[model samples]
Target: MAKDKTGRLHVTVKTGGKRKLSSKLWLERQLNDPYVARAKREGFRSRAAFKLMEIDDKYRLLKPGLSVVDLGAAPGGWSQIAAKRVQAVEGKGKVVAVDLLEMPEIAGVTFAQLDFLADDAPEKLVAMLGGRADVVMSDMAANTTGHRKTDQLRIIGLVEAAALFATEVLNPGGTFLAKVFQSGADAELLAQLKRDFAAVKHVKPASSRQDSSERYVLATGFRGGALR
Candidate 1:
């Protein structure tokens, strides 16, 4: 009923035997989520903006005029923030966003409706960029099959693909950020990133829901020593 400075609301909802306690609580939480309201007010496509905000605030990414690619940018919340920041610099900047689902337009952003896993996806992205990018970000999560191991593998597969594509498209000193489940990143994925990037760190943003198993991996300073 009331919202505090933290954007948390003490919402009351009657379960009425229609739903489980967890389901009712989750619905109520989403309904009263201040970030949701803030996103609506700020014209963000999803509350995911806060997640990116928290990440950038901590890591100092999203510089002005930087070239960036937003993978799995269906709702375009992360792209929205990136577009604004990158547009602030001279000579213009690029924010190329792609997703399997159609996204409503956001100014200063280029949207592509295509599956990132498609065979020609990397080529299409390269054509759109006309060059390498400074940052590559992915919030892609596979449609969960409810089978823990299967879902983990699916997400890891996507993350791995995104990571490989980043290696192909990112310039020297570029950064890669992607979401991953708590099942932990695959060993080969970590090994590849460590070899290609100067540093890799895992981060959990504060805006992320406490119950969510999602975390982000930030790999920065691409070696680019072998990209040629």
Candidate 2:
């Protein structure tokens, strides 16, 4: 894979002998996906990088030298982008990336392998940063159980926990972005974000696959409301 100035990745297709239908379909899709090609070309670990980039481009959450936290950072796509931009700016910028899976090393990014739901996780993240973060972003999703309601509820739980964590850790005017579902965020969660942030909006970036129901909630301008 190689990248161009526009951050587009180009990958060469390799033909492997006969494969299962699903595998073949997946391979074909990957070969044709512009985001996947762009990611590879640009040296990003995953195609999800475009989602964060698009979101930031619209909301302007990313700033040089600002502390940022990335949750569910497996493969470190978002962290990679954040690290590159933040490191370039110098200053006090830092990125703390956490996931249950190991991520390849990236300059200027701290990786932690731990469950965010663990009681000590927030403290661990804060300790790593030495301070609150300017941005708290989460792409965490519960493993789908194939039951629609069950999956949605479990994902909502994760988002709610992430939101609560943000309430505790975000600096004033901080931003929070979390992946949600087509059903949208829970009413209570949306209400809480509205109370805590100056603006709360839901967005679906074009980079996100059309068939996927995934959406994102972007909360900005933290008000430092009651976290506990």
Candidate 3:
């Protein structure tokens, strides 16, 4: 490891033994990533916590007394920030985290290991939240195949599902945040959101890697068109 012009330590991971070149490069990037190190020091589950932190700091979307739902919230980084901002552990708010995989417990977060696409998911989440959610956020991404178009379609499908779930579970004037790629939310999706929300925008936080195309689609001020 050596310090670069940015004064950050740069690491080199040589492809040793059976390690592929791609794997070596990935390891090297992880070793040199500042957010990864910061997450460890700050006790956050993943570096993704900083993305939500940065977005929330600017938007003030999370607040005390708000009810929140985290879709596909494994590893619980976003949930941690939501809990703190919403004061969930203090009983001033509620946060429900749902994922297909089991997540270790997080303070002030209720974990549900279930697919959000299931028929009863929206209702179940609203019940867990003790009322409609003031915010529904998702950091979920579909596992990518080598095929770019297929992967993009999968991601869009997931985000669309999350948005629909949010509409069903969120309170009037609520917010929705979801991770998206460089192509951004599809035009059709954006049009629907424009009708449902007072504001909709695509945002990339400083914590999100510039090299990565990942960004977030934020929609606020829900008009509440839930069917039962």
TM-scores of the candidates in the order shown: 0.87, 0.86, 0.97
Lowest-scoring 10 consecutive residues by lDDT in candidate 3? Answer: 219-228
Clashing residue pairs for model 1: 1-10
What lDDT score belongs to each candidate, Candidate 1 first?
Answer: 0.86, 0.86, 0.92
Candidate 1 vs candidate 2: the lDDT winner is 1
RMSD of 2: 4.8
CA deviation > 4 Å runs, candidate 2: 1-24, 88-91, 225-228
TM-score for candidate 2, please give it.
0.86
Ranking by TM-score: 3, 1, 2
Task: Write out the backbone clash pairs for model 2.
Answer: 2-41, 3-41, 8-38, 9-37, 9-38, 9-41
Better of 1 and 2 by TM-score: 1
- Residue 37 lDDT (model 2): 83
Candidate 2 residue lDDT tens string, 1-228: 676567766454455777666676677668868888899999999999999989888878888888899999988899987886667335448999988888888778888999877877777787888888889999877898979889989999999999888888888999999999977798999999999999999999999987789999999999994334
TM-score of 1: 0.87
Q: Write the per-residue lDDT of candidate 1 for residues 1-228, one digit (tens) a residue.
A: 776668766777787766898798888877877788889998888999999999998898898878899999988999988888788324478999998788998888999998776777777887888778899999888888879989989999989999988987798999999999895577889889999899998999888887788999899999974332
**24-68: candidate 3 lDDT, tens digit per residue:** 988988899999999999999999999999999999999999999
